[model samples]
Target: MLKAGDKLPQFEGLNQDGETVRSEQLIGKKLVIFFYPQANTPTCTVEACNLSDNYSKLEKAGFQLLGISGDSVKKQKNFHSKFAFPYDLIADESHEILEKFGVWQEKTTFGKTYMGIVRTTFIFDEKGICERVIEKVTSKTAAEQILEA
Candidate 1:
């Protein structure tokens, strides 16, 4: 798992619009980078909607939000449209960025085990250094915690 003060790894991936978004491009700005398991699933939807609802507040606080998932760009587009998400959703189909951040892990539920993304959020300072990592998020108040952080 990445920790506070660790330098973010360099990576490039596609966003919902198929536009290339590079990690280095987020430098010189505060960023809220979040990782979720899948698109349109219950938990994922709630988490995403929470962020979408408070997007103005988050942006007003000078934080740019970027959501990453293993879904393809096409799926990401559908999710964004369905949820009316105002922020960027990166399609990390290869899990390259997910692996780099160490959010991909072995998980088990209902006697089923599989590799998946553990809901994670990284707060990066304007200098592109990690300020904090939210290892497990299970509530909508996550945005509040992030804003307070």
Candidate 2:
């Protein structure tokens, strides 16, 4: 898992709109890059919605948000539209960004183990340095976690 003070890894992925989003574009701004296990799931929805509900506060605090998941662009689009999120959700179906950010890992459920994304969020400072890493994310209070960090 990435920790505070680590440099943001170089990455690029397609957003829900199929537009290219690159880490370089966020270099000079504070950013909240959240990694969710899947889109539209109950917990994921709460998390995404929490952020959306508090988006104005986040923006006022000088931060932009991005959500990344292995869901396809169509699914991401649906999720985004369904929730009316004010931020972009990247379709990282290729897992390139997932691996780069170290969120891809072995997960177990119902006695089955498999590789999947661990719910995590990386907050970066204006210079692209990691400022905080939230690994034990509280979906219902995600935005508060970021704001109070």
Candidate 3:
């Protein structure tokens, strides 16, 4: 997975509203990109909502938040509206973005192995250099974790 000191890779994808969002547009902001397993799942919702609840706090600290998942555009749109999230959610259904970040990997569940997304959040500085990576994310305190990171 992407780590501290790595460059934020160039990416462009359809957002929840079906509009294209590009990484180049985030050039001058401190970006927090959280890659979740999927949309609307219990834990994912908690983390997203926590960030939404603390949007102002993060913004005040000069951080811009984004969420990405291997979900469809329609699903991402629904999730965004359902929670009224303040940040854009990327529908990386093709797994292109997930793969680029190295979050897509093999995992074992119930003694069976399968490919899946491991939850992670990458914090990047204004110049697009990764500053921190939160791999063991705390769903309920995600915003606090980001801030402290």
Tell me each candidate's TM-score. 0.96, 0.98, 0.98
Top candidate on lDDT is 2
Give residue 50's lDDT in candidate 1 (0 to 100): 91
On residues 1-149, what C-alpha lDDT tens digit does candidate 1 reach at each position? Answer: 88899998899999999999999899987999999989999888989999888989999999999999999999999999998898889999888999999999999999999999999999999998999999868557768868888
Q: What is residue 42's positional error in candidate 2, in angstroms?
A: 0.3
Provide the clashing-pair count of each candidate structure.
Answer: 0, 0, 0
lDDT (Cα, tens digit) per residue for candidate 3, span 59-92: 9999999999999999999999999999999999
**What local lDDT does model 2 show for residue 93?**
88
Give me candidate 2's TM-score against the actual structure. 0.98
Q: Model 2: residues >4 Å from true position, as ranges?
A: none
User: Model 1: runs farther than 4 Å from truth?
Assistant: none
Per-residue lDDT tens digits for candidate 2, residues 94-145, read 8999999999999999999999999999999999999999999999999999
Name the candidate, 1 or 2, with the larger TM-score value: 2
